[model samples]
Target: MKKIKTPISDEEISELQIGDKILLSGVMYTGRDAALPQLVELIKKGKTPINTNGIAIMHTAVSDAGIAPTTSNKEEIESTIPFLSENGVKIHIGKGMLNDETKKALNKNNSIFVITPPVAALLTNNVLEKECVAFENEGIEALYKLKVENIPGIVAIAHGKSI
Candidate 1:
């Protein structure tokens, strides 16, 4: 397994390969489909709450109940992935296969996409803390900020390449 600390560098990302085991530590932002577009708009307006550069974006909105990787196949949100990449998102964590558009975006942007196993309870154990950061009215679909440790995943696609 490869252990990676966040604010991940290009060299670090380049070293990853499809199916490689990963244990990621540090901070990752959370957002589901509802908050994704808002985040993109925030970036466009130059008013984003946090710098996305070298950071991972996990697909999930949270509540006290905890989190599990959300479906990555949401057509509305998946289409905007490349835009997120252009704005500095480096890692995307979710479940399921990505569409062609998202694949192309990942390729063009040097980002890595990971697929977490469908073990919500196990996944939640990795999260040290989480808080709603934006779009609270969206409820579970609100944006969240999470501090995670030893979060396990597999590289489904890495730096424009995939298994």
Candidate 2:
């Protein structure tokens, strides 16, 4: 089992393994398909609805049925990667493989892509024993899994900003 703090940096975003365990603590928002495109537009227009720096923005559309995770929900065609990187979003959490365009953006943006299964999200939320927004990189995935890492999942947290 491993731990990471949320709202990380471009440097800390790298270095993660497939079967590593993660626990995130920080006020996080869910960005469904409906919201992502608009958010991307905001990034392009020189603005953002929420603070992207060092934050975990998962890509799961929450429905009355709960967070419905889609494999090919948001590709570069729908929302470009530059939008996300330009806005300083440190991480994107979700399942499914990222398109090559998305991968390029992630690498360029210096944002880590921490994956978690849809079912484990709620449970991972429960076992969040600590808060770590600044960052921690315990291991690096030599063979980075293109697909989502199931079971032993990933977590990242925020260290709260001053009021």
Candidate 3:
């Protein structure tokens, strides 16, 4: 039972490949579908109200009846991810698979998408604990530091490859 941190550096992420297990020991912020548009809009205007680079993981999630399950998620991570990645932000944590576009973006931008094991929710329950997690507007929240592996990605296809 080990806790993984987030908000790693490019060098650290570089040490890791498409599929490698490693621990992330850092703070993360939770925000998802309903919240992404605002973030993107802000970034479009060159106004990032919140500095995402501080937190290790920018979780696209929400809380419900005392439970946090990631709802509808998207890979259109521009404003935030692209700008954040350009600004040195580390990881983009989300549930399910990222579109080929995001995978390409992350790979091109030098970031990694650490997937959480969907089958084992309670199994990693210990990850949520008295870790003293904090964020703007959301205040104090419990987070599970998951050390996960990644999958292969391709942003563009070659001459013979079809989308």
Candidate No. with top lDDT? 1
Which clashing pairs does model 2 show? 5-132, 5-157, 6-132, 6-133, 6-157, 7-54, 7-55
Ranking by TM-score: 1, 2, 3
Q: Give the Å shift of residue 26 in candidate 2.
A: 1.2
Give the Å error, residue 23, model 2: 1.9
Q: Please identify model 1 stretches exceeding 4 Å from their true place.
A: none
State the displacement of the C-alpha of residue 8, model 3, in Å, after optimal TM-score superposition.
1.5
- CA RMSD of all predictions: 1.2, 12.0, 6.8
Give lDDT tens digits, candidate 1, residues 68-159: 88888787568768888877788899987887778888878888899888677787888998878888899998888889998898999875
How many clashing pairs per prediction, in order? 0, 7, 6
Cα lDDT of model 2 by residue, 74-155, tens digit: 5532254346665776756666655555666655666555566667355333442222222112111010112122223453
The models' CA-based lDDT, in order, is: 0.84, 0.49, 0.45
* Per-residue lDDT value at 89 in model 2: 69
Q: After superposition, how far is residue 146 of candidate 3 from its true place, in Å?
A: 13
Model 3: per-residue lDDT, tens digit, 1-163? 2234455556666655544444445445545544555555666687755566634444434333222325224444333555555555566654555455555666676766655443334323424432322233433232222333221122121111213
| Candidate 3 to truth, TM | 0.59
